[model samples]
Structures are given as structure tokens and as C-alpha cells.
Target: MKIEACAILAALLFHSLSVSAQQGETAAAAGFSKDIAPILTKKCVACHGPEKSKGRFRLDTFEFLMKGGESKSASVVPGQPAQSELFRRLTARDEDDRMPQKDDPLPAAQISLIEQWINAGAKFDGPDPKAPLVTLIPRAPHPEPPSSYHHPVPILALAFNPDGTELAAGGYHEITIWNPNEGTLLRRIKNVAQRTHSLDYSPDGALLAAAGGSPGQWGEVAVFNPTNGARVRVLGSMPDTALTVSFSPDGSRLAVGGADNSLRVYDVPAGKEQLVIQQHADWVMSIAWSGDGTRLASASRDRTARVYDAKTGDLETSYTGHQGPVFAVAFSGDGQRVYSAGRDKKIHVWDAKEGKEAGQIGGFDDDIFKLLVSGNWILSCSADKKIRQHSADKRELLRTLAGHNDWVYSLAVDGKSKRLASGSYDGEVRVWNLEDGQSLAAFIAAPGYPAAGETVRASTRE
Candidate 1:
């Protein structure tokens, strides 16, 4: 009986060892799309990806990653980590020789995972090895917003629907819609990026487009149904935040600008990419479509504003008078002139065809954040906590709407209601009677957060 028990125990032990070995093999087979791609995209791809390829090495795709660079050595050897130049640089001892030269070395766990993956034969698991790394990694669901806020979040973006019935304000990972007249919380649309920098409604008000993203990781243009708050579609997954989005006069086309230094245009109905203009050397901060939809004007951190043929993506002209980063841009009602403002603290109006400075609007105390051309009036918001109206043709200051305690980052106007809305960095959204410049309504945009002396119970009841 003792011999039989010993034999049985030995068989069970063998089975356990077999299962352990299988589990180890599975663990060593790190998925390229899931495990390895995220690490490279977050840490290494900024310097070696599509936007800027250092040493002519591009890790934007699996195919380009293995193609190597000027090193002449192979970037990857199917089953040999030591023989791979990419792995060698990652593990190099010399600081200058190490990959991601300026950043700290990759953590040990991540390095070990790469080593094990290579040893396990570095198989391509994604559907397309030629596709960009951003497409390969599955996006995790975004976290939910807090039920109530401890403090106010800066309102960087705001918009009023075409009818001016509801207002939308950017929040942390969400957009909050409110009654412009009553300052009542209507609803919140969730599942957005970390920050929303700009918002606009289509000409017909069928769709609302939001531009923003995580600062250094990725940017996108999120479209939604303003009525029901259902996401319509998403566009542009660039390397950095998409700072601005504008709809064409016909509402058939949408233009997007990004920190990726590229301007992308999309067909609203077909959802197809129309053109990609990359003339700017830095972040493209804002976009404005011409009245006739034939041209587009863009503001950039490159200290220049450029005009482009809307359909062909041809460069019409570039206005460089700002001498600093341009934050806002708009085309005149006639489509013959462009108005741009930024760190220069003045609105520069120029001839669109020749890029010549026509006139300037002075008296701004700080950098301007937005420029809106409504009828004959040009509305602008600035870091000086004021929104000023100027004549589009004469370039004369008309009225100053001042009340925001912090920088006014965005502005929206309603022609029918004769009301204007402005969002500030202090988390305040204010509505004004456009005719008299009188304050109509004001409230903190954060959901479930009490206003001034109001209690949390009172806020939640709404």
C-alpha cells in the first residue's frame, strides 16, 4: 500500500509540473498589441514615432520598427533579444547610448517583459503589423466623473446650441449641459478625454464637435448629438491634444487642428478624411472656415496664422505679424480678411489674399483666447478677464463685457436670442445680454457642485 501511494503521489507531482510549465510559457508570450505597444507608445514613441522620427527610426508601426534606422544592425531578431539592436540600446549602460536618451530608463519589469517576449519569439499578434501603434492598442474605458466636486474645474471650452436654449461647458472627463437662462444643470455627457479645449455646433445644429485629449499622449475630435448627448462619431487620434474644431458653412465638412502640428479636414456625412495640411511647425491651436466654405484660416503656436484652400489643402497665404504664438483666428464676413490674436495682446487684421496687415485692434490687457465674427461685430475673449466686441470692417472697439474673475477662455454668441456666453479659467460660465452687455446668468459648471451659499443637498436636488 505504501509503494502504491508513493507512485500515485509522483504522478500527481508530474502533472503539476506540466501545468506550471504551460502557465510559464503563456506568461512569457507577451502580446505585442496589449503589453509591449503601450510601453513604447507612452515612453519611446514621442521621439521615434510619426510626428518626429529621431535617427530616422520610426516605431509608429511594427513593420517600420523592425526595419531599423541608421544603425545598419537589425532592430529585432525573432527569438534573440541580445542580437536585436533595439533591445541593446534599451539596455545600454552608457547614458548617451541608451534609448530615450533624455528620459529615464524603462522600469525593470517592463524591460524584463520585453526580454521575455523576444525570447518567446516576438510574434505579431495584431491584425495589421503595418497599422499605426495607436490603432493597435485597445482603448480602456475612461473613468467616471465624481458625483460631487471638491473644487471647481477650469472651464476651457464652452458653446451654445444654434437655438441658444442650452449651453455646454467642458468638465473633467465630461461635458455638462446647462440652461443658459436659469443656470440649472441639464445633463452631463461622459467618456471624454482628460481635457476639452474647444467646442462648436454644426450649422444645422445636428451635431456638436469637441476637440481635446491627454496632453502628450493623444488627441481626438469627439462628435455628439446635442439633444440626447449620444456620441455620433470620433475623429483624429493624433499624438497630442486636438485644440480646436470648426464646421464649414455648409456643415458638410469639419476642420480640426492639433498640437501634432497638422490640420485635418473630414467629411461630416461620409466620415472620410478629405485633407491633411502640415505646414505649421508647432501646435495648430485654432481653425476658422470662410463664409463661402472655399478657404480656411488657422492659428498656430508657430507664431503664424495660415490660410488654406478648403478643398485642395493648398496654402493660400501665411500671416506672421503676431511674432508670438497665435491662439485664436477668424475670417471676416466678406471672407476677404482674417483676424488673429495671441500672446501679442492685440487683434491683427490682415488681407487674406496677400497676407498683408490691414489694421489692428488694441486695448487688450493680455493674450486673447478666442475670436468670433458675428455679423459686423468681432467678439474676442482674453486672459485679462474681458470679452470685447470690435467692428469687423473698421477695427474699432465697440463694447467691453467684463466680469470674469479669471482668464476668459471661450466665447459663444446666439444671434436669435441676442445673448453671448463666456467660460473662464475659474470654472465660471456667464451669459450676457449682447445688446446692453448686462449679466444675465452665472454659475459654476461642475455637476452636483453647489453654487455660492447653496448646500450640497440643494445642488443634488436639481
Candidate 2:
């Protein structure tokens, strides 16, 4: 009787131990949504995503990932990492047989996690198997900007408030507003992306919109209150950085273009996506709205400039004469023509309706970076370290502002104050007198980096 009782207790202890071990393995398994999805989406989805699928293989979703593209063999076999083709390809030694062909191999830690997941039964932990990997990933907050600068950051975007009292320049992970005339840093708005690529203020001056993001990871459009430097809302998010943003003439809509090759428009007050245009094959480098707000035009790296019907999001016309990647675009005041500039190094004017080249302005020393239409003048900045103003109607060069020491990447104009601001690759911001092109005040937009004669205060909190 004593022996039988002891045997029964031993059996129960063994069963309890087995159950605990199983639970531990289940908890230790790698999660599809949290761990595996980010790796595949960043490394593999560019080729095997909705836009293009090579070898009929796609890893955008859990269901499709296990479906095994074109191959009769299983892509991922539960409980067996050695038998899984996906795991084998990831661990393959030969360059030709390895996954993510041209790119660098996945880090060993990531590979080990994937192998552990497959060995633990490759289970689906998310709510849905067909959901896209992009949706499964949560939005992570951007890192805080440096309290003090060790080096000056390049300024890629600049803007003036509607009343022209302040100038805003893009800094690393923040936007710094400066007193335009005195060259004093007025305020710094934080929580921006790694880079702010474009900036624009609403027609009424109530809101300021900045478009930018981490280069290949995330994109965002943030709207802020110009008076207090408070972030009012975020307009859009994408898979890559948002390159440029433009507010409609009436301040009712905002159009954003990005490296993802899509044009997105959002209703200002509602903060809802109104239209998404994906006609461009490469980055939509620049975007502009017509005077009447009925049409939109975009310049792209695919060597094309396109006009679209704003209301219906339909292609109106495509201008293909640039023959190189076009970087900047602007609509004529009358909305009858579009002026675009690019690596071709000439500003081309084309009829918006006919898509035929109307005229061209030459003599630019290098690639043009940005174009702005203020009053009767068309302002352009280029890699040649010059800013040129031209007659909007005649397409003739009127004035040239030449003092920048590096490629001028951005331009902003305010007719009320007769002021123009330009940012360059050398981290300099030059504010000029719009009437005579005289340098009004120039300073490095970088906070904490004092210029030759002036000291700048570094403030990242406000």
C-alpha cells in the first residue's frame, strides 16, 4: 500500500513539471507581430510587397508568408527550422542562395530569433493572419533632440508665418523659429522627425505644417499652432519620409508628397485623408497647389512632372520633357501653366492643359532644388549656391542672389514683409530683402552652434 501511494505521488509530480515546461516554451516563443514583422517589412517587403513581387514570393502578411511563393516545398514548417526553406535561405552561405540578395545579411540575433520561432511551432499570435505587417507595428515615439549641438545640422526646409514676423528652419529632430530681422532664436518646437524636409504655414497663419520622417522607416506630417509652438495634430503617416508639403490657397486642404512615391491630400480641419495619388514611380520630390485650389502638380525622380484634378484625384497631364529627375514644381498664378526645375538644370514652363513645353529658362550652374511663386515672381534655389528670381509671366530671369557657400536646398517668401529666406547644405539660413536681394540677416540655424559674431542659445524643451 505504501509503495503504490508513493508511485501515485511521483506520477503527479512528473505531470506538473511537464505542464510547466510547456508553458515556459510557449511564453518564450518569438511573436510574429512584435519581432518578426519589423524585420521582414524593412528588409524584404520592398521587393515582395504590393508594388512588386519577385519570384511570386511575398511576406507582407502572415498568411501569404507561409503560403510559399511558386515553390511546392513548404516555406515555413512548424516545429522544424531545418526543414523550412525560409529559414534555410536566411542561413544559407552562398550569396546567390541567400535571402535579401543584394542587401547585407540579417543580423545574427534576428536570425536566431527567427529560428527559435520556427522551432517553437511558428504560431500566429496576432488577431488576424491576413492583416498587413505595417498595421501590426505600433508607432514608436521619436527620440529627443540633442540638448547641445556638437556639429551644425543641414537645413532642408524653411518657412515664414503668414504675417512674416518669424522664420522657421528645420533642425535635427526639431524646428527652430527665429526672429527674421534680428537673427535671434525665438523658439524651438520639439518631437519632430529625424529630419524635417519641408515646412508650410496655412493661409490664415493659424497652423504650420511640417513634412518629414526617418528616411526609410517612417513618415509624418505634423501640424502646429504657430503662436505657441504647440503640436495641434498629425495629418499623415507613411512607410517612408514625407519630402514636401503644401497648403492649398484657401487653407482648406494640405497636399503631401514623399519618397514612397505617393501624393496624399488631407482636409485641414478634419485631419482626414481625402485623396491618395500613386501615379509616380519614384519619389514625389515636390508638390504645388493651383491658385483656385482645383488642381495639383508634382515633380518626381522618375523624370516626370504631373498635374492632377484635385477634386477627383485624376491625372490631368504629364510633362516628360525634363529628361532627368525633376525636383521642384510650382503652378502659375492663373493656373494655366506649371514651372518645373530639375537635374536637367533648366526651369521648364509647360502648358498645364496641353502638357507641351511653353518655354525654358537656362543658365543655372547646377541642379535646381526648390521653386516658389510669390506675387509676380518665381523664386528658385539651386545646388550652384544661388537664388534666382524670375518674371512669372515672361519666364525671364530678373534677379540673382548669390552669397550662399553651399547648395541652396529650400526657399520661402513673404510678400507682406518683403522678405525671403533660404536654407543651404552648409547649415546657413540667409534672410534677404525681397525687393533688392540684399542680405538682411544671416545665421546658422543650428541651435547651440554660435556663428562667427553671434551667440545662439540652445533650448530643446519649448
Candidate 3:
């Protein structure tokens, strides 16, 4: 979401957990309200609870068990006692001592009782998961009219502010800010200009810069106060509608990409054009700054992506392999890699400094629009209507999320939890808990918020 025409993203808190064994019915419930708490407390809690926390294992509650031991696998499934890992470890064939280490396993009758409880679906009632985690209900930035989906708006871009407090998005010349948790719009920074095209927040979160223009024509960029939405200064104008904008890591300068096949850099405080590079042979599709602010990567419609030295405005190198226009580009945290996705239906990983093609990513049937890198994972959205997670190094597809019904246009990452938010051409923004592909929020905007009953979700692949 963009605040005051500059891109500022709201920090989102994600909720989810990845489970195994295909999510069987009641594996975790192997011991129920009447059966399990006491068993664990009597046999396990002493060594595992807060005081000792032996093996970094704590089993005072179901959530603790769900967040099993250091091995990181499900210990007690809610259903399916047969596959419950705890059962296997306890009933080990070698009985030198299976459970309790020195003592024998729980008596046979007690074990049977536990099995029965698990089969019933581990219905937990001990306490709410957030009792210890004070959940802060975010103040609503966008008002809820009995329903937020009643009226929907076309969305184009989204970004989180440097400090992670605000979100900004543009498309209808309108920017909406959300608390990121309460799902409330903190403020709506309105822009009356023709479709707003680009947004970026200064490194300090005090200044915001937005760039856009009449479609097909050169555009303009503006700077504003992030907290008040007051206009600060005009960054300058573009030769064509801009595609993306970025603030240098130090927040000293702003870069803009345009349809005229060029990238321009602007000095922020002075509000003057610092350099213009006629690099891409076609419309520049995307641009990203390395973490250190020394380099910038650009993806373009010419089926190529290139690196530039930010200081000299000189061409560094061009990496090409896309069979189609490159739509998106991003630099890794350490600035070692550049990830680009495009119309060719593939993602190409390139070494930023050397501009060498590092690896090729495939598994989609359509163009890729946006790409973001986090640690060893690359999160991407595609024309395939899917947001996927992949191993940045191994070139392995990790998960393919199937919720969007239209082309995904933008993507954001939860810097802390590694979750994702995807906005699509379909007028819906879906938040996914990338850890398990959990669909936490379904934000749908239409001309008028539709009745709840009118909402429809695509059938998940069985």
C-alpha cells in the first residue's frame, strides 16, 4: 500500500504452521482433555517444562507438542494414532527403556486410553495459544463498511516502509495504508492523477515518492510526507509511464524505470535527476537495489536484465536468457544474486556482479510478474495465477500456492515470518503463510462490496 503516493508497506503478522503426515484427523489428540495433560506432566513435563526444557523440548501444551522436538517433525498427530511419532518412539522394540528413559513405558491400559483419545481428534481446550502472546488489535486505517469487500478497487503496487510500520499500494491513483494486523486502513493517501504507476518510501520513513503518468506517455514523480500525506516536492518527470521505483539503501537517491526503455536516478533532497541510463532496448520492466546501495539490477521487455553501478550510472553487465520479456527483478539480501521472472514462463538466477546466469527456474505455464528473495528462498507470482516458493540455491520448487483467480501483479514478504501477500489483477489480495500455504486473509474488492454469500473460492486441487 502506498501512503501519499510513495510506496509504504504495512508490517503484517502471519499465523501458520507446516504439518506432515498429510494432516490426518486427530494425531495430536492421542491424549485428550481427560487423558494426555496428566500423562505428559507426570512422565515428561518435569524435564521438558520451563525449568529444565531438556532437549529444547517442552510439552506442557498441545502447541508445544505441535512445535515438536529439535528434529522439527510432528510428534503427536491429532488423529491417526498409527502414524503418531510419539507412539513409535515409546513402543520401541528395544525395551532397554523406551520412555521415561529409566522407567518402563506407560502401562498398556494407559497407552490404549491415549490411543483412543487421539482417534477422537485431539480437541484441545487447555488454553488459547495467544494467552502468553498479547495480540495487539491493529487500529483500522481503512474503514469497514459493515463489509470491506462490498466495494472493490483495482490494485497495482504494494510496499512496506523501511521501519515496517506502513504499507502503500497504487493503481487507481489511490493509496491505502493498513495497520497490517488489524486489517484496518490507517489512512488512505489519495492521488487524483491518472493511474498511479510507481511508489517508494525514503529510508527514513518520513518522505514518500510516487511516480506515474497518463498511460503510454511520459510520467512524473512526486515526494511527500509519509506521516501526513502532505506534498513535499516533485522528484522530476519521466519520459514515459513508470513501471517501478526504488530508494537507495541509504535513501540518498530514487530510481525510476519507464516504458521508454530507460532508468533514471534522482537525488532525493535536491530533487534533481542525477543520471539517466538508456540501457534496456525495450520498456524497463523492473529495478532493484542491492543491499549495500552500490549496484542496481534492471529487468526489461527486451528479454534481458542488466546490472549498473549506482554511482557512475555506467553499465555493469547484461545477463540474457529469457525467451520473453523480463517482467521482474530482485537482488538477494547479500547482493550476490539477481532473480528475474518474465513472459518466458521461467525464472533466471544470475550473479549480480558478474552478470552470469547462475540457474534457471521452471514449473509455471505462464509469464511471471513479480519476484522477491528471502534467504535461500525465492517467492514469486506468475501469470499462472500461482505464487510459488522455491529454493534459491538448489533450484527446487518448494510450494505452489493456488488461490488467485487472476494474474498476480505484485508480491510482498513478511520480513520476520517469511509469509507473503499477493495482489492480483482479479482485485483480490491474498495473504499466504508460506510455511504451509495457509490462506490467512482473502481481501476482495469489487465496485461494490459483494454480499458475503456471493464470495466464491476456487476449488483446491485434491
Q: Give TM-scores for every candidate, taking all chains together and pairing residue i with residue i.
A: 0.90, 0.85, 0.63
- Model 1 / residue 307 / CA error / Å: 1.0
Off by over 4 Å in 3: 1-153, 163-165, 445-462
Candidate 1 regions with alpha-carbon error over 4 angstroms? 1-29, 50-56, 92-109, 116-131, 452-462
448 Cα displacement, candidate 2 (Å):
0.4
- Specify the highest-lDDT model's number: 2
Candidate 1, residue 430: lDDT: 86
By TM-score, rank the candidates, best first: 1, 2, 3
Cα error of candidate 2 at position 104, Å: 5.9
Count of backbone collisions within predicted model 2:
0
Model 3 TM-score relative to the real fold:
0.63
Q: Scored by CA lDDT, what does every candidate get?
A: 0.87, 0.87, 0.70
For model 1, name the residue pairs that clash. Answer: none
The most accurate candidate by TM-score is: 1
Model 3's C-alpha root-mean-square deviation from the true structure amounts to 27.3
Q: What overall lDDT, based on C-alpha atoms, would model 2 receive against the true structure?
A: 0.87
